[model samples]
Target: MASLNKHSIGGNIFLLLLAAIFMLMGVYFQWLYTNESNAALAEEIAYQKAQEEYHDSNIYYEPEASIRWLLLRQHPAGYFVPNPDLLFEPTQLNDNTLRATRYAISILYELGALDSINPKTIIEYVMENYLADIQSAGEVDGAVYHNGPYAGFGTLSSRPAAVRPTMDALLILNLLGGLDDPRLDLDRVNKFILAHMNDDGGFWDEHYAQSGRNSSLRCTSFALRALSIIQGHQKKGFSTSDRERITSFVVSTHDPASGGYADFPGREATDSYFVFRAFISIWSLASGDLAERREYVENHMEVDHTIDYLFGQHYLKDEGAFSRYYRDLQSVSSLKATNLIIWFMTSMGRMEVLPEKAILQYMMSKQNRPGEFGGDMYTTYSALSTFSRLAVSTEPMSQPKKPTRHASIPAYFPLMLFSLSLLTLITSYFTKKHEMEARNHILARQASIDGLTGILNRNGFEEGLEKQIGQAIRHDKPLALIMMDVDNFKDINDRHGHIVGDKILKEITRLMTENIRVYDIFARWGGEEFMILVTEAGQDKAVQFAEKLRKIIESGFFGIESKVTCSFGVAMYRKSETIDEFVHRADEAMYNAKHSGRNQVSTVPTSAKKDDRVVEFKP
Candidate 1:
């Protein structure tokens, strides 16, 4: 070995010093992490201990006092006092109306104290405010659409028609044995509700419809319950296809991840309110006992997962209540959350899953005046109803096992993440930009799909048609257009109903889908009509396929009395002709089939002229 130079020795000393500095920094970070973790863990442990102490304290559910509070909400004249803020003050013109009246009566009925108020007086008030004379009914409401002679109540006394208020009135009046009252027209009411039931199997209030919003579960529940009460049967009022559509809508609203039903399809449930309404709508749709009801619900949603969810994600020990949302328990009202949770539990018939002591204590804490729960009538009704349900359950109380979470992530995690992600974020910027563009492309593609049948709509088909025409022209390739429409579809709709018509359309779509080649483009062209573009195929191949589909359609039943059949017209593309002229020839041929007794395949020969016109072909 050679003797070491002074420069080498100096380099070694500098490296050792750098390593020692790094070690010291590592030690400092560890101390900071440990200190922060201990503080959070201690806080968590303290919160858990406090919750335990609260749970140990005995709480009582008072019956007589609750009845008294509900009674206090009622005026001496028998209608429920409208405002809890002012007790019995009718602040608005229609303040003493059906909403408070229904909730108060419902609460009293739930608590087994319906006899506390005179039923005759309540019915009289409901009739005075809600029931309207058809011919002599006052000026029509511009905000709502109401063809008179239908039974429904407006939001206000002067208002003539609405869905929710009508539902409340129906239940209240029926509970008081006012169904047989001559002033109340059950026939018109039935028609009124059926009108609100959209093809999607959900109900819409004409009031909310002004905002261009679709159906919600709350309104759907009201419509279903109202129709049931009107028909005096659980499941007889709705048609088979109508029931199918309704249940399908309910299924669409179920959020698989949260195991709760949303306000509408393709959404996570936001609160217990939405969950409660969803379950109620499903319950009202089912026509049997508990097991059958469970089965019905299972067909639409994940029952076991939902039942398990109640004990998992939402309940928190520190809060000692089930939070309104599954992901958020902090910074929420314990009173309303606990109350709504109990209500939802009872509605789903899963009250057995609840931790009895915590729910009751939290719920009862909202009652300050003998018990004026929820500051208003709606929540009051919810709380009282929950108490009644709980009074009957024999389930044991046990703390819910909280979902697995990081119990002690370092409090300075955000700072660490910021430092760690700087380099990654810089590298990922362009990648993220490309990802957003791809997402936008996919969204644009999905927009062309039909909402009902999941087929291409007319607009999408036309878009593809232009592209295919361009390709055909460029390569001088053969192409054909086949247009088909269901024979006597309007007659079928009149005989069966729109629901049956929609189902038949879907069935026809499925039949055609199975028979067509993958390259062939099939689309729904508005009502009862469909179009297909056969690429690289002349009129002969297109007509043969059309005839084949027509036979298959006639062979099958499409949820209706008569067998469904299609009339088809096939036209070969002329290399010299425009798309409009090519399409017109197909339309003219299809009409020829229609005029010559339908369910027949009619084709324009390859020799047909580009400008030939069929005089009797009607659109």
Candidate 2:
């Protein structure tokens, strides 16, 4: 009896232990399954939200018919006159006329109307007539100038070389590739520009000789733009410190109270022209911190009275034209002032806030005929540019196509699986759940990040670049892009297995990430190639940054014993250039760096040179 009782007790204890183990297994599997399912759903929701936001920010627009109407005002001389009313009449040309011509050309270029007009002829004429050799007593010998009596009756009169026209000519020539023409001496032009740098590091206007070294925002802005162009072309114009001085001078002109830039430090009144000039100068030169400058502008713009002054006081409600000043309404609205206002507003990315319909109506009213905006060349040009900028049709923003849904599980599967032992069912469920979670994580990561290096992939890099470009354009700030390629990467992969090559890449990425700023974007553009977008950095700063990156790579080591080096190409975004063009320039520069002997940094030339290769600026 004693033996039988002990046996029964042992059997009971074993059964209870088995049941407890099964229960524990079931609870663990349920927890794993629930956590993974919730995680996947959350990730999908977040990804969908991100996709929607991206699409919303990428809306496109079709330009209106008014831009085409303005093109008809082109002059027979291949330039545009201020008024379409003077189409058949001979017109006098001055700085305003030249500037109007530049604007017209830019508009036509933007509108893809090159088929209708011969820009080459217009460019040739400006280069031939406006290019002057200044040999004055105090000026440097053989200094080239864009000669003009800025306000004049006609082209018949000879005028002294002035800062405004010279700067305008330089900007136009740079934009139209006139600087590359052999007929125009870029060296002399460069010298002429260098001569204008004042003791205060700002530029002087036409009266520099008599003005006693005074600097005005207008002249300084023009000079900086021209210099920036030369720097792009020559890659040797201004030093980092020199650029800093120029930027400092421009920032000094800012009116903290009015949120407008003054002509000079002591001047209290703010004008649109001065403001535009100041903004462009900083944008082109990148002399100061861009984010800070943007903040200053934004703060002032928040309460800007210019909009009220422009629309309320100077606007011609019936005529749809804007006058130059609030006090004067008798004369025709100033075309120069109107154009400046449009450009300023556009630069601030505040175009949508203005009365687009009224502005367009006024622009159309100025047209004398189909494809012609009638007024003086300056006003006509202003109206055309304004129309081109504002004429766009908005459409509903579309979201990106959603990712395909995962396969649904069978409803009866869990019940059927329950027929198996508790431990077996729990093991199967946990295995499937773990697999699903790993697969989802990989899919999500692979979309925007490089699989090997764990950095941003090409798609991610492009998206980031697009966002940065938009911000730069909207705020009138500078942006720099860098492209780097690992030298002899193919050879490295061939000599040492691909696994080793990948290890090197991962190390390189880690090293670069540590060296760059927190905001700077570094991405794996492709196998053995990488890209970086440095916001608010000018060409000079970009070059320096690139050089730093190059050195870091050259000096670093991977787990294997090998010396690795990278070649870098840098480019600053140009105003009005498409994203493709901007990226192409950087890619070209990177190629130049690679071809010119790997492990060096090169920059895109401001103007296309004959060889299509940008000469390395040693400074």
Candidate 3:
């Protein structure tokens, strides 16, 4: 009986162990299944969302007709916004003037300016006539803006640290919707911003260029906006660090006392005008949880005072919209204020409060008989936007309807997140699957390299040459290309069984490497042909380098049994020349050297005005 009981106990223990193994196996399978299912569902959901957002509506605003008719009736040539007798002329504020004009161009574009004027021509005019005076965005040394009111017209009287012309230019271009223009020098502007970043994650105004961490709300807001625009073109996702820092800076600057934001941290006075800009810029960068900000604004904003100021119905009660509050009190019907309001509302995606119909009517009524508006650029933009929005919204929308905040789509954020997640999964799967393929690529590269010769195979050389020449032009560096062909390479191959010929070529490459500088690039031009790139070196230095390389080849060989020599032709790159033209010049020079006598270098004239002269090598 005792033996039988012991056997039963052992059997039960074995069964329990078996059950536990099955449970673990089941859990693993379930996890695998859930991951696959969720991934597919995520993709499908994203696709549907993309399709929904991409759908364009052919909707028109009903109120635009009234505004257009009014414009036609009063202003025969152009439309304008009403300008109340404001002491601060929008045109007089240099930064305001720059921004206003740019806003005008943007409105004009929306009004079909491209159909009337060439976009490229407009860009050219801005670059040549305007960009110099504009304060560059991002971080800049104050020395660049030392002259008083140099760019944006912000003299000591108006702003203490205002030098935001660069921001103005970027905003203007954005308003014109020309961010993708290849001609725009975004790289330079991006570099400028990078220089001005303070240790506290905010940008300093020109007034405190490098003194310390003097942050301003206006500067930080504008900087964030410019960075957001520039980063859109970059392929790499912006790291969370960048987003976090910008959000913190903007949030810290908020004024607890006034229910508004100061231009920067520690600022005593808070203004709603700068608060709007800061919020808009922060939103563009996707810097913070905007939902929280919206909650704060709803619960804390000084609503009554803010509203009174926007329409000029109450002076001093309303914070001036764009850094000129005191002056704004004089211009009761100034269109700059109206445009500022519209811009803020639009940026926040809160169109309901903008009084679209009323603003449009006011703007249209101000038009002169000559078809131009009496108001400045700011007024024209506000009026046009109000009219256009009204024309497009087929849905009968009313004024001052509290919008459901944080309801609008980010347009890029969600899509980017989805794309990034998808990419991560795909990359992980492929990395495992193509582990062997990755090895094969490395092997393939090795195979293309002739170990002894140190020159690329014909395929590699062709690819490398194209890439190097392209890089040279892109960086605007000097490129000296040399194509060398052995005058009697075939004879050497015929006499020496190709093995000796290979050794000769290998020796030639070794000799060239020793004679060339680190920046100078050399590759086997082709069968007996060779190429060299003299980076940042002028034509004279290139010629000297080429001569030295040719002499080394003339004197050196693999074995004393065989004497080998090469002829070289050099040519400096010309802006207008194609790759073929540039290479052909080198080839012609090489042939000239071979005919003139072997073991020599030949070159073309580098002077821009000189005729293309070919000089044969004596050494």
Q: Which stretches of candidate 2 lie over 4 Å from their true place?
A: 1-97, 130-133, 136-158, 207-213, 235-238, 287-323, 326-338, 365-368, 391-619
| Deviation in Å, model 2, residue 455 alpha carbon | 51
TM-score of 2: 0.43
Higher-scoring candidate on lDDT, 2 or 3 = 2
Q: Write the per-residue lDDT of candidate 1 for residues 491-519, one digit (tens) a residue.
A: 78878989988899999989989989898
Worst 10 residues of 2 by lDDT: 148-157
Residue-wise C-alpha lDDT for candidate 2, range 1-619, written one tens digit per residue: 7887888777656644554455455445555556666666777897788786755444333334435555566766666665576666654455456667766666656556655666587776676554344554223324323341122011212555555666666666666767777666666665665566766668876534565447777778777777777777877646778767877777777666555567787565335566667767766664335566465455434325545445655566766566654333353565566677777677666664566666665665566654445544455556666755775433445656655544254334444444345554565567668988999998877888988888899988888889998899999999998989998887789789899999899999999999999999999998899999999998788888889888888888776577898888888887788988988888888877775767889885344546443546321
Model 3 Cα lDDT, one tens digit per residue, 390-409 = 55443432322222323233
Q: Candidate 1 — which residues are off by over 4 angstroms?
A: 1-57, 82-88, 92-96, 131-148, 209-213, 233-236, 308-313, 325-331, 334-340, 347-349, 392-619
Best-to-worst order by lDDT is: 1, 2, 3
Q: 264, model 1: CA deviation in Å? A: 2.6
lDDT-superior candidate, 1 or 2? 1
**Per-prediction TM-score, please?**
0.50, 0.43, 0.37
The whole-model lDDT of each prediction reads 0.70, 0.67, 0.56
RMSD, one per candidate, in order: 21.1, 20.1, 29.1
